[model samples]
Target: MTSLSTVLKESWGLVEDRQDRVAQHFYARLFLSDPQLRDLFPVQMDVQRGRLLGAIVSAVQNFDSPEDIDGYLRSLGRDHRKFHVTPEHYSQVKVALIDAIRAHAGERWNAVYEQAWNDVYDHIAAQMIAGAAEDTEPPYRHAEVIHHERRGADIAVFTCRPLQPLKFRAGQYVSLECHYQPRLWRTYSIANAPREDGTLEFHVRAAGGGWVSSALVRRLKAGDMLRIAAPMGSMTLDPQSRRDIVFVTGGTGLAPVKALLDELTRYNRTRFIHLFRGERQDDDFYDRRHLDEIAESCPWLTIVRAVSDEQGYPGERGAIPDVVSRHGPWRDHDFYVAGSGAMVNATLRRLTEMRIPSTRIKYDAFTDA
Candidate 1:
């Protein structure tokens, strides 16, 4: 008898190559089975389809890890409450998912494969349903856009005032839904520290074909109403930590890093800090002036700018991971990394090789998808 992990791996391998088709087929089957369920999804299925496949892959890969599926799935389930996901909907999804996988896997599909998938779905559904049951927060928080500022060409920073006193720690992110897009939602890190005024800030980097991001960056304006879900993220400030800190940020991943910096300022005593900012080139330095101001005021903070694929960069040249490798040992420092998936993975590998403890590292991979 094949183990559950091995079965899942082999089955996914058969369908992964045709993921787009499988996602399409799955949604088609789902809506056909229960036409009313269509209302829960966005009108745009392109991004949603990819998200489904990504979620499934992530679940399978981490289901049995030490952190286990519960941690990630519970967080996902809680956030999914904002989407109006219910236990009944999970039934439709599982049926659709299995039908699609069987159709795609063709001859590779067997009774054992079917049983393995059934068990996997059962476990996933149990965890998600259990988590959702305990979540008591409102599905979404009402926010009024107080300010919208664009930096360079692709990114926009928005300041919003939650209608209620929205409580969240620095370095956390929330899923945002614009009134204009109806059910469409995107995740973005909060860009500032918790304020007495109870305001929130988000940095959105418009990615091609991202409905929520393009709308947030280019079309959304001050005075527009936005709905934000409860804050989610673990890359938050460690209140007890007194060790030296290292921050590595790429692109708009700088949002959360900036928030941590803001939080650090309120602390009476903070260890020395090193920040590495990575981008395509100098023009992409969207928050340099602000970062410079922070570095200037906080003598403990040092900023290093690195540019890759650009010629004649003045300070540091090459990818951020390479710059971090060639420059510092970073030993004994609490490291925080926020960046694109590739950037985060590369930096973590390098950080481990530099003898940094895995426990001391915190990272969030910023993605609009």
Candidate 2:
């Protein structure tokens, strides 16, 4: 008897190489079946396709672990409410997904594989529905951008005051939709910890051609209102235990780390904290002044600046993995890593090599959002 995990893993390997085709075909089939569903998604399907495939693959990879499966599915389900995903859409998605796989997998996809995939999809959909049912608040809230700051060349810091109190943990991220781009939502880590007022902050890095990120950083101005979805992500620091904290942040990935640090400061817990912020050059350290101020205020905080790829940089220059290892034996510390997929994966690999317990590490990833 084959386990569900083995079935899903094996089938994933068959389709991993041609994921691009799988995503494209899946959307084509989905849109063809119901033209109305197409409006829910962004006009530009290229990026969304990859993200969809990646999300599905990630789900399958973690399905074997009961906790991973439950947590991820619940988050996905709850977050989908903001996208206005309905019960019927999940059914449509499963049909499109299975059809895409069947067409692409060809001879390799057997009845057993089909059954296993179907069962998994059924579980995913069920959990998603349960999650959606549990949420009662409005799908999203309105936030006015009261403050905007351009740091470095392309980093935009926006301070938004929500119409109502948007309760969220320090390290959680929020999906924001700019007026300029309707229905085109992007995920940005809330850069500040919970404040007394009804306000939240985000640090956005404008990539060369990223539509939302580019527009927010370059074109967005104060007084513009943006639609905000419920807060998502599980990056909160453990409040009960006063564990030493270690953070590895790449670029604007520092946002969540900053929030976590603020959380620590709020509690005034005398725990040791180390933050290694990596950038390309000294100028890339947009929050240097702020970080320095934080270190001054918090005696237990230590900041390590790592600059890579630039010559004669006036800071400790090396990749994140190298600079982190130089800091030496970081035993018995809760590690928080926020960065691109490559940065997080590489940092995790390096930390594991140092014999740190994998369970103790917490990750906050910044991707297209």
Number of the top-ranking candidate, with TM-score as the measure: 1
How does candidate 2 score on lDDT? Answer: 0.85
Candidate 2: residue 165 lDDT (0-100)? 85
Error of 2 at 218 (Å): 0.9
The alpha-carbon deviation from the true structure for residue 330 of candidate 2, after best TM-score superposition, in angstroms, is 1.2
* TM-score against truth, every candidate: 0.95, 0.95
Off by over 4 Å in 1: none
Q: Over all chains combined, what TM-score does candidate 1 have?
A: 0.95
Local accuracy by lDDT, each model: 0.86, 0.85
Clashes of 2: 0
